[model samples]
Target: LCLALQDRLEKVEKEVQSLKGENLALKLVLEEKKTFASVVKDGEVEVDSWKVVAASATKCTLKRHSAVDLNNRFSTLSDEIRDCGQTRVMSTVIKTVLLLAPAYVYLYINAVYSLKSSHLHYREPLTDLVSQMQETSTAVQNSTNGGHPSTSVYRALEIDHTKASHSLWSEDAQCSKFLVNFGKNIEGTLLLSFPRSGNTWTRYLLEGATGIFTSSVFNDPSLTKAGFLGEVSSLSHNNTIVTKYHFLQKNHHATDPCILLIRNPIRAIASLWAFKIVTSWDVKHVAVIDNSRYNTSEFRNFYQNMLNRWMDVIRNALENSRLRLLPMYYEQLREDPIKEVRRMLNFLRLKPNEERLVCVARHITGKMKGGQKKFNPYTKNEMNQAQEAVKIVNNLLVKRGLPPLPDYSKYEN
Candidate 1:
């Protein structure tokens, strides 16, 4: 660019020099045409030293004073004009040099943008490369965890939690059979809820929100293959499980954080009766009721059993400092599920942005949602007794710095 401007400047200088030469030639011609002409016209002899005729057909004439010196002033002005032209050009060049960085930057940006526009067809390849990088990362993780069979039932989604060094299954041979050592272990989070108190619904909610499967610590035949500590516990420390009971370890084992899902005691007892008596799911109660001290009436038996279980679990959690227990209410879950689930996620130290739809619809109860023949069958006296039992438990819980149980008398028959 500088070279081009230099050439242009040279051309301008040549034109200026040519104009100066023409002016000089005209001065010489006027000097050569100077004639002394005396005219006796006014009584005194007045003289004109030079008169120059025009060279063009327009009849323009030039008059020159013989004594007036104009060359010095005219030449000085011509030289200043030449000097001004050179100064202006030099100023422009200096400014251009100072702004070169910005000029280069502008050109570079345009060039890059043009190239990108022309190569728009390569977008798919770039996308594919990003996908491949992600797939490679996932493959590396799977390999680090010991490769599972392609037909492996292990899930793709997982809850990330800190793992405790201890195991739930002690040295028992039966429990030891489930221990598998395929990969790194993580201490799992415990999803605890009183049975028949939205436990199943909470499990489903966690699964749908996190895309991770919750395993049962119970050796339920359905989840037998779903153990987490490889073969021993269905809950692998690498994942979180929603279990009904804390495993009966010798001195209580340290594991992941626990979330307790509970409901108003009255409703919970009613649901327990439905599970044990009406549905006969509590086989221990159903199978050995005749041989035990439990009341002959299943409602009374379930109420007493579940209440004791509730107090035991809550008291245990309260006493154990290592147990990080987050208590969630079933009524709150049923009323505004999203808010409760978000609270649970925050408790687990997990991001609630995982999924907004908890998929609790499957476990939602309707007006007629009872175990076999169910209704508001408890009398006011029975309801009052149940309320009092819950109050005693709540009083103790409050003294222990835990939350009180809600009154569920409204749910009584």
Candidate 2:
């Protein structure tokens, strides 16, 4: 028992030495931790932090970042987010433009095509309509015959005078007439005639033959009541067979064809004075008055003034008119009414109907003609002045390749 006790004491001493060595090691480790903490507070030591990166379910790695490195990483992450947002917005804008591109392109192409077609439609000549109608009729006839066209071709017929019918203009003796609306498809002609140049009578003949209304610049109630339905219509409306205008000074740019009716100044002035005196100064009177009643010295100064005016109107028209001109004489119209009417219609691009023309021939002298002949109201000097004016107009007409006026000294119409 003594020996066993001794052995146990030795073992206890060995264990106490081992414990002292362990305590010394632990104190060294604590001192090292305190020194490191103090160094950190003094900014002499840098600290590193680790992040775990999982490669797989069973595998992992550590990633370390310092404070400065962490801030750089966050800044890089924020920049990536901002860039992604900007890229998404730009992509959306590109997609939207792409979606609308086809529609904008289609609209631009369609507008260009429509503008070109409209120009072509308006610029086409009005005379082409007749050929187009004929072609359409021929095509339809051929189609109806099942590609075996007729041997007899369709053709437009000339005016046949043998065909007889009642008047298409009026049913009564008052020259009251029916008129078709002059549609937009037909272009207009200008009837330029000076005052008292048988313009009213010519309008009567035109309406009788064509059954189309003639428009006047002045809206005279008397003439309107006497079948001038388009008297009040505007000239720019362009819906009449002929529009009467005495003054073309402001309308020098008119492209319409003109029918300039000329009359002997002596007779025209005499007839105008008689008509004005009879109708109380209404210049648009449609009535034929007694010329012998007003043939006196009162016509001397008026005749000179009217002769100058007559020359001025003719000179202005010949100088300023830009389109085709058909110069007509009232005496010629009085002599051959049917021929003159047909000539006028042809110039207007209208096909004359024979039945209506026959009616015009039958009523050549209208109700306005009475039982009296016109008297000469001009003096010998006035007559000489009228001849000189005619000579000047005739020279101008010859220069323009138009026919000259007849000898007015012997005119008896």
Candidate 3:
């Protein structure tokens, strides 16, 4: 019976060992389930089955899990790549805009203000909009007192006239009514004369009467003398004025009933000499008795020679049949400008405008100031020399039906 009990104990012990081994296997399986649950919760794997096989099972389940993980990684990498590409494109566009911003702003402001300024706009080709804008600007400028519209208009007209050829005098063959009545049909009237022959005074008197003379007229001395030519040229071209001044060199397309103003040769020489001395401060030191300078010899020879030359120029100018060379003495202009001017008006076939005559008279006389006094009487030697000169000049005057100069001896008192 004791031997039977020992065998039973051994059997009991073996059974206990078996139960422990089973329990350990269950624990391992529970631990594995917990780990797998955690991994699955973290999105590492998805399981098709929970069967635990050891020796006979292949690694198919793990391999399947690895493939799923690889696919997920590929999708994440692809999404990241797409997002990076979009970010790069946006960044490139923003950088381009930043680089061009300054130049764009500069161009915009310049177009609006500087490029559209009035002077700049005038240079642009005329469009419908630009034309309307210019008209409005001109109107506004005219309305404003300080805008100087007249000056601007005058400048524009002057520039246009300057670019035009001045030789267009014969383009219009219309004759003046006065020239028609005077038994002549010519293109234009010319006031012919030598240089420094009171031309400025005459122009001043004529222009001042019309209230057209301004400070600009006399600002430049050279222009003050020749400015009348330009003025009359412009007026003649526009058919505004009937008469004009020609310095004799530019004689083209003659007109009838023109006037000539002549001076006493002796007085003209004296005036010119005085002018030269006063202006140049250079005394002419050549001996008048022996020097051939300026055709001077003794005062007598010079006077007679000058008178002859004067007559020749006048005669040559008178040869033009279209010209009505009215040779008026300079003394007549000084002594009685009104009567002389009236005679000139009558020759011009113009009714003497009393207001214009009065204005002209005032202007000529008003210019004679304190400094324009007559020269002192000739010296004893000068008087004797002048007396001889007067005799020769008087003979020529008498030959031309002009009054002879009085003897200087009679004026010694």
Candidate 4:
């Protein structure tokens, strides 16, 4: 009897110790919840602590409901226990077990309450966190798109992070099903510029210097046998394929090195306008400003919009280390075409042969021989508007350590 009594005492002592620990934890949680509830009522929430406060309030609300249900369940269970007269059949040891068991019961009830409260507490925050992630994903897509969602804009939509990137990578649209697919390869050199910035001329010069023909980055069937490519497939040295793109696009191969040809917006505006006369290439994904859209004859505002968009492209390009930038000005091309072509050849890692130099000379002569460019068409007021636009772009580029494109209004072509 003494041994049994002693065992009961030990069990009682252990329960007492456990109950105090559980009691303290519950007190702390409840206090935190109460504090949160008061803060919420006051209508001022610290941004960092807002989530915690919200969670605590939810937990407290859940705890209250759980406690009420638990109280009713215990009352019913106690009545049933007394009516069955089960307590009378117990031996002294069993009775002792029953006497010491309320602490365990209390612990069990508190655990269930805590678990329910905790579940309610975490749910809202988890939902908010997911909402925030979705918002960030959307922001990423829009920001990457320079301006509007189009083929020319380099878009990184939410779908890109999930499944679309995989689809783009695995399936090379350039290949016919009859021809074996050569898989996605992001290797090539990109000759990129704003439209009418001597991009085609540069491409021709680069071709002579490297003995490589250029392809359009876009998959126009008119440009190539393979229509609408995300990137040129092969990266082999034997391949003499350099690609040209009018604008920086979202799917453009970031892995390729680029030569950015910046022209004087004043002159480039005229050059772009004249391109209607010279070429008939079906370019895609580029924003073409219609001459009629300019509300004023000066077109300063019109050129300003293009300049702003171009700067955004340059800023995004600066962020990407993989897209190496080799900037050349159109004015520099006029200063010395041979030197510029040789410098570009160096960038492409190709040596110019006698035949190549001869070809380039012929190419430049042929361009010079072409019909007179829409020359001296703009009034002095129009020229001044262009110069003002150049100053805005120039000041911004100079600070960034990028070369400023010279205003060619004062100089003869």
User: lDDT per prediction?
Assistant: 0.41, 0.53, 0.35, 0.44
Tens digits of per-residue lDDT for model 1, 126-229: 22322222232222221110012121212333333343222223354433222222223444666655565666556656654544545565655422222232
Candidate 2 residues lying further than 4 Å off, grouped into runs, are 1-181, 250-253, 280-297, 367-372
Q: Give the TM-scores of the predictions, in the order they appear.
A: 0.45, 0.55, 0.36, 0.42
lDDT of 4: 0.44
Q: List, in order, the clash count of every candidate structure.
A: 14, 0, 0, 5
| Candidate 3, 1-413: lDDT as tens digits | 23433453344334433542552111112223333233222211222221221112232211112333433433433233223332142232222222332222122112222232233221122122122222323322322111112222211111222221221112323211111011112223344444334544544444433222212111333442433333423323432112434233323433444455555444455444444334322222111111232333444454445545555545545444443434555555655666665444434333334434434543454331112323432345654554555466556545544444444333311
**Maximum-TM-score candidate:** 2
RMSD of candidate 4 to the true fold?
Answer: 27.4
Error at 367, model 3, angstroms: 4.3
lDDT of 2 by residue, 1-413 (tens): 23533453344334433542541111111212223223222211122200010111122221222434433333433233223332142232222222332222122112222332222221122113222222333323321111123334332323323322223345645333433344343456778877878787787788777766678888777666555666766557665568887667745745666888998877777766666567442343544555565566666667778888888888888887445678888888876667677567656645555445555666776533322235666667877888898899999888876777876656674
CA lDDT of 187 in candidate 1?
A: 44
Q: Which number leads on lDDT?
A: 2
Evaluated against the true structure, the overall lDDT of model 1 is 0.41
Order by TM-score, highest first? 2, 1, 4, 3
When 1 and 2 are scored with lDDT, the better candidate is: 2
Worst 10 residues of 2 by lDDT: 48-57
In model 3, which runs have C-alpha deviations exceeding 4 angstroms?
A: 1-187, 209-256, 277-308, 366-413
RMSD of 3: 44.0
